[model samples]
Each structure stands twice: as structure tokens, then as C-alpha cells.
Target: MASTLVSIAGYHVTEEIYNSSRTLVYRGYRETDHKPVVIKLLKNPYPSFSELLSFRNQYTIAKNLNLPLIIQTYSLEPYQNGYALVMEDFGGI
Candidate 1:
């Protein structure tokens, strides 16, 4: 099921937390720093232009937030033919 994304070079996905038609969310960590991270990736490796735009919009909104309780977004990365939204993982989702 396109699980090729589980072990990318900079991140290691420990477990998948959610799956939907549009996205895949995983609990993972940054390889170099061993920092826990949440990865939200587009389900399709090659999504349509509109889908890509929506995904980017999600990242933009998340990264701009300054709320203390909301986990912070670290980066929006190109991965596995799609994009992965990396965020701070507070252990529970």
C-alpha cells in the first residue's frame, strides 16, 4: 500500500497513526537528531495539481500558527513522489 515511504533517509516512521483517501499520518523521528516528529504525507505519490496545492496550503497554515498547545510544524518536505509535512510530535495525537 505504498509503504515505501516508511523509511526515508532523514526520517524513520515508527508507526502509522492515520490513513484516509487524502493523507497518511505517521509517528516518526528525525534521523540525524532523533527528534520525534509527525509526518503527514499525501496518499498519492503523484497527486494532481489541485491536490498538491491543497497540501501546500495545509502546510502553510500549520507553519504560520503560534498557538502554544498546537504542535509546531517543522518543515514541508518533498518525499516519495509527494510531499511530507513534518511536525513536532508530542507523543499523543
Candidate 2:
């Protein structure tokens, strides 16, 4: 299996609590500020190419629909099993 490296400069993945469906919680730091962010990771088990595409598309649609209530995506990267989405840091905001 190929591994995907997610590079977040000022953040670290939290080992405490995580939800399999909705979020990848992380502890982030910038200057003197310590923050938490929930990154939405694209998930699929034994997914074919088409399945992966479906997940991607559905995620896009869901993200578009929930734009106002939630934070916007800051970046996206390919992961080992799926894709990693970097969302807006909303710790202080």
C-alpha cells in the first residue's frame, strides 16, 4: 500500500478523540496560539476507482451545501487510502 504524507506546518494530529465518519481532530499552533481543527477525511474501504470518484464528488456537494454553517476547505492532499482535506482553523474564531 502506498502511504500519503500530509504536511501541516503548524498543526498536529490529536491522538485522544476522533470520529471515523466526520472528522480528523488536530492540535494546531501558530505563534502563541494553540488551536484545534476538524479535518474531514475522505473515507472508503476496498474502494474501486469509481467509488473513490463518487466519494470525492459527494464530499464536494456536501461541502458546497454546508458552506455557511461550517468552515471552508483550505487545502487538499492525496492520502494513502483516500484524500486529506485541510479545513479552516476555527479555534479562536
Candidate 3:
């Protein structure tokens, strides 16, 4: 489910959260009885080839981890001229 109500950093997020990355990260929330979750929004206003490659690497790494301790990558979608990853809603480490 895509949202435009809130934004973290520059990427569109579900709620306002402080994240220390160039990409925006948010604690996803919904009014329609939904579970807590973390949503990562890819912030690439003008992505270069290397940046795209790095994102691909991140995708690969997330796919390979496939274990506990690390949040699971549930889905990836194209959004805001970039991509977003919906992951398991494990709270901050």
C-alpha cells in the first residue's frame, strides 16, 4: 500500500522518523488495523549507474540474508522515480 500522508527526509514515508541514511526509512502505520512495519523508500532523484548497481547489490544482499536478526525483504516496488522495499517490522537495533 502506497502512502503520501507523511515523508521522511525526501522520500515519501508513512510517518516522520529520524533516519541517518541518504535514503528515507519510516515506521509504517495504517489506520485500517494493520501491523507495525518498517518501510524503506529508495531516494534517488537522479540515480547514476553506480548508485543503481549499489541498490541492486542491496537487493541481492537482502535476498541472501533470508534469516532472523536481519529483517526480511517482503517486496520491492518502483516508486517516486526509484524503488521501495517493504520489510519485516522489526524495531530498531
lDDT (C-alpha, whole model) for all candidates: 0.87, 0.53, 0.61
Off by over 4 Å in 3: 1-13, 29-33
Check candidate 2 and list the clashing pairs: none
Candidate achieving the largest TM-score: 1
The true-versus-predicted C-alpha distance at residue 54 of model 2, in Å, is 3.8
In model 2, which runs have C-alpha deviations exceeding 4 angstroms?
Answer: 1-11, 15-17, 21-36, 43-46, 58-68
lDDT of 2 by residue, 1-93 (tens): 553433454546543234466334443433235545545554453557775677577557656765577676554556667665556666542
* lDDT: the better of candidates 1 and 3: 1
Q: What's the ranking of the predictions by lDDT, best on top? A: 1, 3, 2
User: Could you list the CA RMSD of all candidates, in the order they appear?
Assistant: 2.3, 6.5, 5.8
**Model 1 lDDT per residue over 1-93, tens place:** 655447666998888899889888999899999999999988887899998899889889988999998789999998867788999999896
Q: Compute the lDDT for candidate 1.
A: 0.87
